[model samples]
Target: MHGKTSLIEHNGEGVFQGLNNPLTVTRYHSLVIDPPTLPSEFNVTARSASGEIMGIRHREWDLEGVQFHPESILSEQGHQLLANFLKR
Candidate 1:
């Protein structure tokens, strides 16, 4: 589930997912070296538990993160976590 990094000094910490598409994987590597450079700001969006966005996952071409694990009560009202983190 992990891929090795090229940096011998900071290597062995593989964050890449092996199951990712080859093209997507290539793009990921490129991004790691030359990041797309976002606005340096945080923007969190709210999504319902039963909503269509919670279960989505992507890489390179798209990016997403889930504030809730949804498997237990640990993530209770997880959307609030995103909200608070974005409050600056």
Candidate 2:
């Protein structure tokens, strides 16, 4: 999967959720950036709340992005992304 894009928060009766995109299990509180096939020169945008960038990491040969689903697909770039984040 790509990642959470253009999502909005949903709240009701003390329950919160995100819609209009991938359901983010992550509350955008802490992001362990795991760059996948994404290029290093590319600027990844992470708008958690209001207007602000959570964090960004510079790398030599790896890339990563957000994903609502736990990607363990070997065919996908999930491993690469995780490796990148852990390796960095």
Candidate 3:
């Protein structure tokens, strides 16, 4: 990640269901990279403004992951994001 803030667009499925789309989050990473390969069982649930994969979920497995720092106070809806995940 390059900026202090990042835009994350949700796919409105899985763990991200009913939450705000295009969420603005605090990013403080030195390097941004994509996964080499994604398994068929996983679904992309979110992406950055630049089309970088930002979130993924395996509904059947009840698994989810996010690339941004949702725990940071700077994130607009970090608390909500965490809540959603816990509810899953």
Against the unseen true structure, what C-alpha lDDT does each candidate score? Answer: 0.25, 0.34, 0.78
**Alpha-carbon runs more than 4 Å astray in model 2:** 1-65
> What is the model-wide C-alpha lDDT for candidate 2?
0.34
How many residue pairs of model 1 clash at the backbone? 0
Query: Whose lDDT is greatest here?
Result: 3
lDDT of 3 by residue, 20-40 (tens): 787888888845545567777
Over 1-88, each residue of candidate 2 has an lDDT whose tens digit, in order, gives 1334323222211111122222233332343444465455645434334333323323443443442322433223334434545654
| TM-score for each predicted model, relative to the true structure | 0.19, 0.24, 0.81
Minimum summed lDDT over a 10-residue window in model 3 is located at: 30-39
Give every collision pair in model 1.
Answer: none
Ranking by TM-score: 3, 2, 1
**Residue 77 alpha-carbon offset, candidate 1, angstroms:** 12
Compute the lDDT of residue 49 as modeled in candidate 1. 26
Candidate numbers sorted by lDDT from highest down? 3, 2, 1
Which parts of model 3 have CA positions greater than 4 angstroms off?
A: 30-36
